[model samples]
Structures are given as C-alpha cells and as structure tokens.
Target: MFNYPPIVCHHDFSKSDLSVDTLPKNVSFVRPHLQTAWGEFSLVEATVQAIKLLYESENPPDWFILLSGTDYPIKTAKQILTDLSLSQYDAHIHHQEIIYKVYQENVKMSVMWQMLAYRRYCSWNLFSLPFFKDFTIRWGHPLLSKPSPPFSQKLRCFAGSQWFSANHRTAKYIIKFHSQKNSLTSHYRRRMFADESYFQTILANAPHLNLKNDDYRYVDWSTKGAHPKTLVMEDLPSLLASPCHFARKFDIDVDSNILDQLDTMTLP
Candidate 1:
C-alpha cells in the first residue's frame, strides 16, 4: 500500500462500517459530514472537504488522488507514485467543454447530451397529479447573462469524471476557491450531477494549473446505460493492458475472481 494518510469523509446519509477507534493515527474522518448522493452537490462538497483537510494536514502529500470505494488500482503503488513524480501536469483531469443542448423526443442521445441536459437544467416540484411530478419536466435558464461570473460566453462550462489526481498546488487552489461561497458553487448547487462538473469547471478555468485531459482511470462504457459497465473477470486482460493506473465500477460480489487475480499480479 502507499501508506499515505487518508481522511475518510463519511456521508451523513449512510452509516460507515469503519471502526474509527481501530483506524490508524493518520487516518481520520471529516467532521460534520453532510448527506451525499450520486449526481448531487453533496458529493462535490464531500470531496472538497477531504481535500481541504488533506491540504491543511501537518504533512501534506505532494500529490492527491480522489477515488471511490468501487475503484481499484490496476498499477502497483510504486508505479503510480513514480508516475506522479515524473508527471509534468499539475493535474490529470479528464475534461471537455460542455455545450448547451436540448433533448430530441425519441432520439437516442450520447452521454454528453444527458450530462448537459441534467447539469444545465433544474427540476421543479410543481406537479402533484398521478404519474406527474414537478421534476418530470426539465426547465432551464439557458440564456445566461452576458456577465455571469465564473461562467459566461467567455468562461464556458467544462465537465468530466469526478475522480482524478492533482498535485499539491492544484489541490491548494481547489480548497481556496471552494472555501468561499461563489457564483460557480451556487450554480453547481442547483444543477444535477454537480460532482462531474464542479471540480472540472474550476480546474479548467484556473490559468496556472497545468492540466492533462486524462484522469488515469479506466471505465468501460461500451454497454448501454447511464452507468459504466461493472468490471468482472472477463475484463482482466484489458484492465492489465490499459495505461490507466486505476479501473473502477468493480463488484467483488459479482466476481471476486478479478480482484483475486489482481491481488496476485500486484504483489511485490
């Protein structure tokens, strides 16, 4: 293992099975955890909280990596650490400019379209009839102001995977920016799947952060669904061959064989 300290941020909504007392001295939890759910700003806030804490720690790491429980390392710890050491970019963040787009009825759309639709629009609870809800209809204020701070014609929106790696400098920048309540943060609070866009928007906009448009995480999305394909034993070959340091959406319950094999491969 890397042996780097971890600041576990528990979601307020879900109880953590981790025994706090048994955890190492370097491992701690973020105080006053908030309710977190998929596609919610709470997920963003949780990440921000952990970053802030880690950045302010007594012995802050030179690099920071954000990951979920479902994620697993494909490369060895030494390989990952060595990669970060020789990396030129401040952050490995998968990102792209998000365009404002509307859905076409009965038309198959890409995930980008789905991301734009849910991220740009807000749902209302105005309808209460049977099989009707306020959120059933998506409403948006696409005609943003000429000078919408943090986001406008000049400062466009960018989005990407929520998980990634960043150097200490970029990590510091994130905490400093997010610590203040800003228009960007406010707008993100209103949108859905804020986790995917919030950090990306900030990183993309920062002038000094040397960013690479690669998150170093492999996720198979070939199958049809809003979520990525759950990794299994069949994916072992691709996972090992990929340049990515990590691969995600693994389900040990579905097939622990994959993880078992990886464990053998990763043993020093």
Candidate 2:
C-alpha cells in the first residue's frame, strides 16, 4: 500500500492518463491551466495551481513533493514515509549564500546584448510607427524584466535541484506569498534563471521553514551540465548504497535496467 499522497501536473491535459496509470491508488490529478510562457513563468503558474488545488480539496495531503517525469524512486514507499515522519524539521532545504557567479555573468551579458539588438532593429521598423511607439515603450521593458524589483540581489543564481517536499502549511505560505507579491513575482518569473532562484530565495526567506540539507532525490553531478548525470546500470550499486530517498534524470529510453534493479531492490 502507498503511504503518502501523490498529485500529477501535466503540460497537456490529454497526456495525463499516462502518469495517472503509473501511480498507486492514493494518487490524484491536479491539472494546471495551460500557460505556455516557458521557463520560470510556466513553473510559477504550475506551482500556484497545484497549491490552489490542495487548498480547495476536502482532505488535503499532509505534505506535497514535486517530481519530474525523469525521476525514479530509490527507496520503498514505506521507507520514505517513515523517514519523513521521524523528522521534526520541515522538509524544505536551501543552501545559504551559495555562489552563482557563472550564472550571473552569463545573464548580464545576454540581457545587454538583447537590449542592444532590439533597439537597433525594432526602433526603426516598429517604433517609427505612431501608435506602435507608445505600445512598444510600454511593453518593451517587460521583455527586459517583468512584474519587478528583481527576484534576487545577485546577477545570477544557482539552483542546485528543482525538487522539494513541503508540508501543507508551508505550501500555503508559498502560494499566499506569491499572491501578495504577484507583480514582483510575475516580473522576476520572466527574468533569467528565476525558475531555480525564485522558489529557493522565497523559501529561504520564509520565517516558518528552516533552510537545511535538501531532502529530495539525489543524483551524481560530477559530470556537469544543466542537469545531474543520468543514472546507468553501472551506477546501480552506489545508488543503492546512498541514503537518498530518490535519484533522477533517468533516461526513459535505454535506462530501463536501472529501473528494473530499483524495482527489485525497493519492492522486494
């Protein structure tokens, strides 16, 4: 039997069944309104919708954990639930003052270049038109930064892992905070790398939850890229030995062996 609640959010409602089929009996579906802004805005809308569903539910979940399509469990459902119950601390984690120098540098350069390019081209063709000038001036700044007072003080921010598990009260705060700061949140959501930085910063700044070690699944990051290294059959032994409850970036294609091994290990 499954020990915790599960909720799935899909970009496309029609494809929801694929995920629903894989979940155990306790899981349910919470579909977000289709918002196709990409990156941070998309994630913000998805998060807000998920929390709203919980608030409206007759019996809300004790906690909510976010996962991606690429994630897989390394521990049994029972083991995970048991571990969570024993902890007094809320599950949200943030690495304090984590340096994100590289990301900041890249964002500054990219923003500057985009502004220059848009001014050069759009100024002549688009801005020269009478009504278009006011429209362009009003909307053009949004392309630079939306809803505003930028999300973070740093030029760029590093988001270690996107996954998190938060108790119901904490989840409520996240939703409420965003609602009050809708303008600022909306602006930063359109900015660079806000997807990773926004939530991390908000949670870190929250008074209720303590920022500590990350509680979600773990994956080796020695290789380097935008994501953690995908687990392979060869990595099975080490993965099993690690205490992390989940690990991810699994290839849905050829990484089936790792999943097979996990099934045998966690289920048996």
Candidate 3:
C-alpha cells in the first residue's frame, strides 16, 4: 500500500479561502493559493505544478494518478496494485477524436449542438463567464476558426474525461511536450473543456508513449445529464464488480451509506 499525501492546490479566483492544522506527517500542503481562474489553462497549470512538485520531492511517485475531490476508490489498494503490476500500457487514458457527428444526429437539437461543437471555443462553463464585473481573467485569444493546419495534423486532437493515470515517464513526457509546444498549448487553452483534450492529445500524438485508452475510472454516462449521475446504493453491486480502480461523481450527501459499503470493500 502507498502512503496518501493530500497535496491541496487551493485556487484563489473569487475569494481567498484555506484552512488546515494538525496535518499528518506525510501530508504536504501547498500553502500559497495559486492565482488561477476556471478553465483549461488553470487546470493544466495545476497539473504541471503538481508534477513539478513531485519531481522536486525526495521520494518521487512511480505512478501519477489524477483524481477529483468527488472521486472514490472502487478497488482496494492490493487489487489496484495487482492490476497495475500486470498491465503493459505506459499510461491509462480514455480518448477519442473530437468528431461527434454520429452522436449529434441521435440527440436533440440543444444537446446536439453542445456535443457537436462544444469545444469550438472557450466558456462552456459558467465559472469562466463574465459573472463578476471586476474579475478580469484570460486563457487565450479565440481564433476565428480552427487552426489552418488543423490541430490534429499538428498534434492530433483527442477528447476524453480529464481523469487519468500515467507512469512517471509519461507524466514527464506530457510536461515536456507542453514546454516545447507553446503555440499548441496556447490554442488549447482557449478551447472549451481544455483539460479533457490537452493531455490526451499530447499523449496520443506521441505514439511511443503506448497509452492504453482506458482511464480505469468508472463513470456512467448513460444517465444523460450535465454530469455523471451520483452513485447511490443501487449502484453498489455494479461498482463493486467493475474492473475500474476508481468511480467518480459520488455524493455522500445523497447517500452516505454507499461510502460505508465501499469502505468495507476497498479497505484492508
């Protein structure tokens, strides 16, 4: 089993808020609140910072797993290690091209447009909008159209869920790729849901990385909602049987008992 160290990156955009005391020995809290606005660049920046921190640490991690606050482990530590040890892929990331033409025809007009051209420009989420009069922020200049050479030709644009697990080598490659490809990073920064495509595009384009195209995180997109449905008691059996190591969008407030059930199954 691995030691869990909570490296909290508190983003300060709207307000300054942070509180911590009596920390665990392994827990290393980043005290300063990074000046980050909501969107792709901010998310990318946070990830880069985490990677940098990891590299600088005395004990660098072998595997870099990105999980949101809402994410919960579906498999025990032993089980997760067993899967990783036996896996041959360099990285685990579920990805595909952004072309959603087939999906667009099946859905309603409103949903169709959103799914079809949602990544055309930035500001898909309200947090990036001009909600606050004085809150000035920027990700990148919006292009009149997709780049002339096509992003795919330049680096191969891929889209998928942001959560992923990559070995240290793959993680370093992503950061290195970002450093070298300034123009591509700048262009993606302005795109809606940049995090979803940025890393996927980078890793996918670099075929030598040997990405698995399976993020190993269970998410139910079948419910048809703005986000994945919150896992409830009814989802317990399926989740327990899943090969995925983690499951996302669980709300304990909705059903705290589900967490208890998961804890019994996941913990040693």
Q: Which window of ten consecutive residues has the lowest lDDT sum in model 2?
A: 117-126
Stretches > 4 Å off in candidate 1: 13-17, 101-150
Residue pairs clashing in model 2 are 104-156, 146-187, 147-187, 217-246
Error of 2 at 52 (Å): 2.5
Per-residue alpha-carbon lDDT of model 3 for 1-93, expressed as tens digits? Answer: 355643434345446554545665555544354566555477777777676666557776677688888999989888887787777888999
**Candidate 1 residue-wise lDDT at 31:** 80
lDDT of 2 by residue, 148-169 (tens): 2433453222243457777777
Deviating ranges (above 4 Å) for candidate 2: 1-6, 14-27, 94-158
User: Regarding lDDT, does 1 or 3 come out ahead?
Assistant: 1
Candidate 1: lDDT of 86? 99
Per-model TM-score on C-alpha atoms: 0.84, 0.70, 0.80
Q: Select the stronger candidate by TM-score from 2 and 3.
A: 3
lDDT computed for candidate 2: 0.60
lDDT of 3 at 235: 90
RMSD per model, one decimal: 4.0, 7.3, 5.2
Candidate 1, residue 56: the lDDT equals 75
